[model samples]
Target: MGTMEAPILTVNNLNKQFGSGCDQCSNPADRRLDKNYCPACGTVYSCQNITFDLHPGEVLGIVGESGSGKSTLMRCLYFDQEVTSGEAYLGPYKEGRSNLFRESSQQKRYIRNHLMGKVYQNPVLGLRMNFSSIGNIAEKMIAAGNRNVAAMEARGSELLERVHIPVYRMKEAPKNFSGGMQQRVQIAKALSNHPPILLLDEVTTGLDLSVQANVLDLIKHLQRELSISILLVSHDLGVIRMLANRTMVMLDGRVVEQGLTDQILEDPHHAYTQQLVHSLL
Candidate 1:
């Protein structure tokens, strides 16, 4: 990882909340919440003042239990969900001066199609199950304004094979594939455009242990081979330990601890982080 390199992504004071905040919950200094939810106003803050920088070719893991807002952060970054308030900058986009969260819809779409790729926890969210696996990859390429059909087909096939999808199955729809295979196809599709940033949200969740291991290994291999910067979200510290150079621990929509993966695993400072580390022991 190039710790000294300029960050490919910078996020500042990102926040996402549901419902209009009442007086009690409006002020952060005076707010009282029950695990990210304000009982008085029924407002649920999915993310609060989140900030981080992802360096070029770095794997930044975000680990937290369900409802800890890790997934919400990924969604906001990928523009799958709107941020209530925040700013994100991508070095590969507009010289990193523009706030991604504030970009026009067309510009955001361009960013998604060119600068970033995301693999959702659910294949359904990331893939068109009915389309041919190779077609899914082509879809992203097409979105990025690639109209050369032969070139797209060649690139799509190459990516699928790189992800370990059998060449024979390139034309098959994802719905007929196993969970792990579907994820592999999704990974291939995400990489089709050669995006600089990849957002991976629980990519290996819900698979059999063996299947999960295979997916994780593929991710590790691909990350190294492509030298891509990844923003990975998962509840599994084991997953974080294997792939992340640095880790951030989120709890109740707030980041409680963050540091090198080894340091956090060895000497967790926050109580919640301590619990998470101990559980991995």
Candidate 2:
């Protein structure tokens, strides 16, 4: 086997805040310090001092409870939401690196267009729910400048095939598919651009155990075949143990422990990590 290369994405001190936006009022309806959205004050700080690196061919799992800022961090990294402060470094070389927090529109667009791909917790949110599966995937390809219908269609077909979605269902709207199929379709769409790094934000949430296992296996197969680095966020320990190379445990807006998956699972250092592990059992 060849030696594995290093990470393509690194995050340092990442932070995001809502309600503080000039657009929101002083007496905001929602506010919380650790919660992505504040309940009392309407101020949301996704978290502070959050950091991690995603290596090629590696699956990094981020685990925390519901209010632990996992989704907010995902949004910031994937560009769905703004970064309040700090840096998200992409790629290895300084020349190729970018700070998601401060990059210009053109720069951000370029990075998003070329390197980023994301799968949301809810597949419908990530997908063009109104379009056929093929149209949804192809729309992303076309927007990224693929205009040859024959090639686009062929590629789209291959994508669906790779995700185990039958070509006959290509014209059906995602609404017709089960939650699992929708997740698979969303994966196909994310891979349409051949992104180097794929971020999955709670992709298996709310699914039945069997379906969740299938989706997890599918993602592992894709990662192996495509050599794409993955950053997976979840509250499930079983999922992390099965799929991740490294795991990061978070609590009250801080990373309490991070290490190889097996190590963290078997022997966690922090009290919060211990509690999380015990709870999982």
Q: Which candidate tops lDDT?
A: 1
lDDT of 1 at 22: 95
Per-prediction TM-score, please? 0.99, 0.89
TM-score for candidate 2: 0.89
Which residue runs of candidate 2 sit more than 4 Å off their true CA positions? Answer: 1-5, 19-42, 92-94
Give the per-residue Cα lDDT of candidate 1 at 89: 96
* Clash list (residue pairs), candidate 1: none
Q: Candidate 2's residue-wise lDDT over 57-138, tens digit each? A: 7888999988788888888877777887778777733544656668777666666656778899988678988899999888
Assess candidate 1 and give its lDDT.
Answer: 0.94
lDDT of each: 0.94, 0.81
